[model samples]
Target: MMPHQPSQWICAGRFPPPYDGQSLLTQELLELLSPEFSFIRADATARPPEGRIYAPGRLRLRRIPEMFRYIHHLRWLTTRYPLPILYAIFSGNPLGHIRDCVTFAWAIPRRRPVVVWTHNALLSLHASPLWHRTLHWLTRRATLFVFAGRSLYEPLRDILPEEQIAIIPNLVRRALLCSQTEVERKLAHADVSSRLRLLFVGHMLPEKGGWQLLEAAFLLRRHGVPFQLTYVGGWVTSHDASAFTRRIAELGLSRQIVHHGSIRDPETLRQLYLSHHLFLLPTKHPTEAQPTSILEALNAGCAVIGTPHATLPEIIQPGVNGFLVLQHPREIAEAIAHYWHNPNLWYSHARAARQLFVERFHPDRIRQQWIELLRRVQQSIPELAQVTT
Candidate 1:
């Protein structure tokens, strides 16, 4: 066992066994940081661990009750720990926003250093001016503000001091990197004789461009281009599922498209990446901070194609590691055809993509950055060191 550092940290965030980005990130942080820190996790949607329950699921009864319970819990935890820092990984839900505000306000009185992990692009969200003001106020009071992408860092740098804002991009494990020789061997055996294998790995929401990707696939088929497309994630909403299914049928793409619904296991996800030749995600949402799917694909050595939205441009260099396209389906189809004509482009780009992942987005490399940020927060709060040790 690794020697535990004397500092104790209570991680308040959304955590698995629920499959979402926030949950995955929280779990990853716990796994990487627990060896050095005495960590306790408090999940929003999960049952409390044994001996940590402040109350039952009574918070689900009403909004006011939930608010009350949240405040009570925040006060109790801070009072009990009285530690130097409280790191919160918050989503953009209304309830969560309020809870974060309350917790930050309470922490301020105790002089506890607070760190807020932002997964969403807050300024891009269609929030009311009042809500924006509240967010600004809360962020100004935080000891450190951590962003998953540089795009987010630009907008928030002025709100917090330069040193207080940390840009730690999401990462993929090193084991996911497959050798080019291995990828080629698997492709040869898969019998993809006539068609290029294109994979889309995200939810079926409109913002994720499910409709756009499906349309591009149809256009490719119409142009007599030989390619197969597979989608490998669940629907975001009921309406999204209905619309996606209707579009797939209307376009007569049943023969060219395979919809492989949610695959959660890490091993299975890596296998999907290895089996596919290209990964496409033309997400239209400007508020999207960063998508882990892109990193996972790069780690698996797949040639990537996505829109130049949010942090995508920071990750993908056009015509280098991958191609970035406009929102038009025709443009996407054209890019696909270009790659089909020059298969070596895919090999070269895939190699570059994997090299980039190893250089910056590897889990072990990024985890050190996170530890350094936590240590800075500790230094800012001298009282926390006394309580935690």
Candidate 2:
């Protein structure tokens, strides 16, 4: 489809230059779903619904005015397109979802076919009675609703008609995926190693289990375990960095830890995921849906150790591909030790992780799911399938 073409499908969601998961996924679908439906993007980039680490600093303050400006323009922009079938990506922040809400509200009178794709599972799952009521009212306006998993949308089965909901997991780009053989080899543990390469790749926020991961590293060192913990990604705040540094020093873990602040290169990031033996993200963040990083790590065939929060339990089968534990340093240390002492166990889990990724998260399967969804929406709402003269 050429640019400026008045397409039947209007995809109004976050789009990337920022490289956040939601935007990247949105961008992928826009590309993949194009042949089936001529497309125009209604991007909410002016402070997207996800990413852009809102640090407790001047930069965050600077984003306030610009955010409103973008939303206002987006409201005006939506009117330009004939949205016979609208697909809007939402990650469940009431504030971030404001523009989409406005767009939905404005189109209520016209009653166009709208499909809301929700990323964060717990938002609707854990809402107050008032919030649930609000969502029911809004969702009833749409022809279809899409979520990542059954566990995510199961609770809404009563509120949303079963036929109206579809569960489609997120997809990983094929290029980023390492071959299964390469992944297994890279994740293979030597019969014996002096040091185990452990990794934690996310924000430095306490809720993200950064403190717990560092403390686990300290405990492992205290036990005289030969392991090196590599901490990657930028600290969300200078204070987070400072406190992390102070904790490492206090625990005498300075030399054993390598803090790679904000790795921008795709190759380097891929190398980190592929090289690391264990990907540790024992996050307790309640709002987390299934994290794209977990899929990425599994794609690289790294054994995972994650807290069973939100949709993580559905993704991680404890003792199969990964260990699900509470955010306790001692428990985390023990899980790592199990893999360390049992190298065979590590290799088995590594293979399992890759298989899990292929069976569930691969783009080929995800693309098929999206195509079915598009067809379902079109067939169910015949007006959407009609071509403009």
Candidate 3:
């Protein structure tokens, strides 16, 4: 008897250049699932023009060529494979959705199964009613829709069947997980007398709460809290960077806070996470979903402090792994002060955070979910079902 061959999938989505949560998660799926499956890469990464930064969300005329390149590749890849499962990220905006609708139009006619990954929840809230109805019509073309969290299903709940929707939380890289020895050493050296180290890892944009975090730091300083806040990301632009610097100086948080720019090296980032006692992301970004930074912090045994936005409330348990605060500076400061007064409480929360990561976002757990979801998808197709069985 011959062994069964791995199923071929045309996995199309954003791969890293800019390295945001969605792009990283897409990369994670491709790398981690390669053993059981084969993939034909259709890179949807919107490469920026020469000497320009790649920003996918911004509306620019230059992106038209990039979109055409992706569409052309996707069409060619689909033709090469025999009934390949079309796994791609479902865009949240009308322009992107229209592009997707056109690119995957071939699959729709042939009744090929497409797995749509939903990483953002902004389309339902921010899009116009006409676009919403259009998105609803376009979304039905997919055989299945995967969501990052349970709360994220609300946007397409009314339009999609219950069986078509599957909840799968995003997983962070395993390298980010600290060793038992490292965790022990970190906790041992972290004495109540020492300064509490707080870390924030994301773009230094106002919407991402960089400014709000600085304001909270000022409030903490006024209350005489002993802490060091490190910002581990680059500003969106030189102008934003300049504005941030001016604001930091004006708030007199230059001494208490520091920006380390963007650290891409995994080992260095892992080390930073291990050294910090708290991870702060008071983001009010409209398109926020399940952020990988929160999971990274959880893996390193650092208690998270974030707003109850998107799928955050599900990820954070108040007084357990972390605290969910309002998007206001005062509330963020209060959450920080909660840990300042009780170092032991912070330690307990840190342990709980690590435990939550182990139980919830472990690589094995995430892999199993993907395998099951893929198996179900394969079972739906007659030819693929025969090959699997």
Candidate 4:
């Protein structure tokens, strides 16, 4: 990273504590870029339209009135540093997407180097005509669009300039925060043959493959493979959670299947990841960007078993770090059984997973990428370099 490059950037997005992928990425960039770049945190709460636009608690007509505040902040950044840019972040949510789009649209002309950092696939998702047009408008105006992964940028090939897009991947943070030696100490002597400790850390939506894990559990039980699958995170629908509870009862496998509800605390979540031998995310959720859970699993030195989708294929190399199985019970069952049969396999994979995290998603690598991208964006606008120099 260019520590001496007089660049002041603003990272505007949802930061951590909500304990999700998007928020975690925002937080990672915010902290990683702090030392080198003069960064301002524009914590625009992209809450859903409270009632209606400008109504009792709506988005207040694009928050356009707040332009004075943004301009003031920009002036302050320029005075304090050299090159001032806005790294506005966005996601797949329709309401938040529109809000960010509008905010960037207004800020683009005024702000020297503005980047729209997207954490998910945009072109693939469905949106209303109005929101769709607004997004396209923002895309045109944005100095650059940063995607979480290259696969995410594939669909936007035609619409967005190739030069304007970059992928830094959803890097891991909690893994680095924890004591690496302590985390690997448990894995080094873990007995994967005896009752396997499996983890599923994602929303309890059907698309997340919560039921498929249950089916795999049944098969593993029938095969006499001792294993425990714990489902973490909250349910999307109350009906689904209730139905899942009943399904566990009907199958008489409540004892084997554990649900920790939603784990928000990072330390607690880190410990949970450390205790488990395998992390399972059998999700076919189409909107799945680079999942932060898989990265967390790797960082915690846990082998992964996720379905082939999104960033899973990129990271979960078959028989390497984790198994990217087809979205089915049989595939998942076979994978669980494989690890149970060969305990040594877990050690090798655990090593590989941690190595992958350190090499690809480490903070040092992420920091350099952010610095380069920021520099690239600043260079695109001739005035930014002149002003900073």
Global Cα RMSD, each model:
5.2, 3.4, 2.9, 5.5
Q: Give a tens-digit lDDT track for model 2, residues 321-383.
A: 989999999999999888778887888888899999999998878889988777766676555
In the range 23-76, model 1's lDDT, one tens digit per residue, is 676677767776666665554544333212212113344456645565566566
Q: Report how far residue 154 has shifted in candidate 2, in Å.
A: 2.3
Question: Which stretches of model 2 miss by more than 4 angstroms?
Answer: 1-8, 46-52, 55-68, 85-88, 97-99, 107-110, 124-126, 187-192
Model 1 lDDT at residue 368: 93
TM-score of 1: 0.86
Model 3 alpha-carbon miss at residue 175, Å: 2.4
Writing each residue's lDDT as its tens digit, candidate 3 over 149-231 gives 98777755677778888988888886676776787687778864457788999877677887888888888888888888999
**Model number with the top TM-score:** 3
- Quote the positional error of residue 92 for candidate 4 in Å: 2.9
Score every model by TM-score.
Answer: 0.86, 0.88, 0.93, 0.82
Ranking by TM-score: 3, 2, 1, 4
- Top candidate by lDDT: 3
Better of 2 and 3 by lDDT: 3
Q: Give the Å error, residue 240, model 4.
A: 3.2
* lDDT of candidates 1 onward, in order: 0.71, 0.71, 0.78, 0.72
In terms of lDDT, the poorest run of 10 residues in model 2 is 48-57
Where is model 4 poorest over a 10-residue stretch in terms of lDDT? 49-58
Decide which is better by lDDT, 2 or 4.
Answer: 4
Residue 211, candidate 1: alpha-carbon lDDT: 76
